[model samples]
Target: MTNERSLSQKWADFRATKAQLFWTGIGCAVATMVVGFTWGGWTTGGSAQLAAAQAGTTARQELAAAICVDRFNAGGDATAQLATLREMSTWERGKFIAGGGWVAMPEMMGKTDVAATSCAAQLVATPAPQAASTAAP
Candidate 1:
């Protein structure tokens, strides 16, 4: 009677919902493909942007090494200078170079390591000045 009628009405509502669900699932699949090919695709602009960012990072590191070299020549134990430079923030390193060193950045990025090593190589270990002369009276 009324119970049977309500059960039929509920089944009808479920039927309409099933059709809507099928269409929604298809739409979601199509959208997934579109996005996969848009940004994740090989031909997309993302790779070029990544390469540009990497190149910029490399340039900055080389500049930092050159500045480290300049600061090195200004004076200090080479080993100590290199350690100090590496510890500095990128902004602080830039300030350090701008504050004093005039050495030029090398054309190639790999040259920075060598420049730091060379600066350290030139350091001559000398003994401190003795306050008293060691000559016999």
Candidate 2:
């Protein structure tokens, strides 16, 4: 009889501990979820768009550099072409490069210079097209 009594007492003790353990586990789970949501960047938006914009900007920069190189290789006045490139805005630079690089002498740039100095400068810098140019000799 005493052994049976002891077994029942142990069972009661385990029940109490189990209740506490269950509640503790619930609390831990809730806490972990709250921390994860708060600290994690799961709520952000438009990351893809931001990345695309960055990539586009980089591509435009590379194109602009190619345009500058073309101008320098033309055997024109490097100093003047460089000055015009520095003075142009990003939009202007893009346009100029897209338009086969700045023309050697535009009528004006923003009404400041008589000819579009930036556009014309590149033309002056590049080498003259030679005759007898062909794919093969």
Candidate 3:
């Protein structure tokens, strides 16, 4: 017989090496996936969707809070209302804001609870202007 080896014979001769290469490739793939997910900030589709939903909710709440603040400040008795709101306990502030109809925007119908709470926080954080009093020097 001639001293030449056919493709099938060569393949058969390297069967052990072939298996080793295959296993090595599999291990490398698994390692890359593990590293990428653990430290590369790679997010799955489900996690990305959840994050997007949460961001949307936060944006909506902030927008509604802004509108609520504007409406509240535009009222004729804003100073008096602000004083009253500041006197109430923290837990009652949201209810007071909601009752004032400041969080009644079209986009805030069912989501008024969170918006009202945010509005109350913004209102509380802002200092109301003091009334000027006349006094004799």
Best by TM-score: 3
Looking at model 1, the pairs that clash are none
All candidates: TM-score: 0.30, 0.31, 0.82
Error of 1 at 82 (Å): 13
Name the best candidate (by lDDT). 3
Task: Order the candidate numbers by TM-score, best to worst.
Answer: 3, 2, 1
Candidate achieving higher TM-score, 1 or 2: 2
Q: Candidate 3 versus the native: TM-score? A: 0.82
The ten-residue window of minimal lDDT in model 3 covers 103-112
Ranking by lDDT: 3, 1, 2
- Candidate 3, residues 1-137, lDDT tens digits: the string is 78999999998887467889999999999999999999989999999999999999999999989999999999999999999999999999999999999888785567789999999999999976976888877
The residue-by-residue lDDT of candidate 1 on 84-124, one tens digit each, is 65666544554444344433355543344443443333222
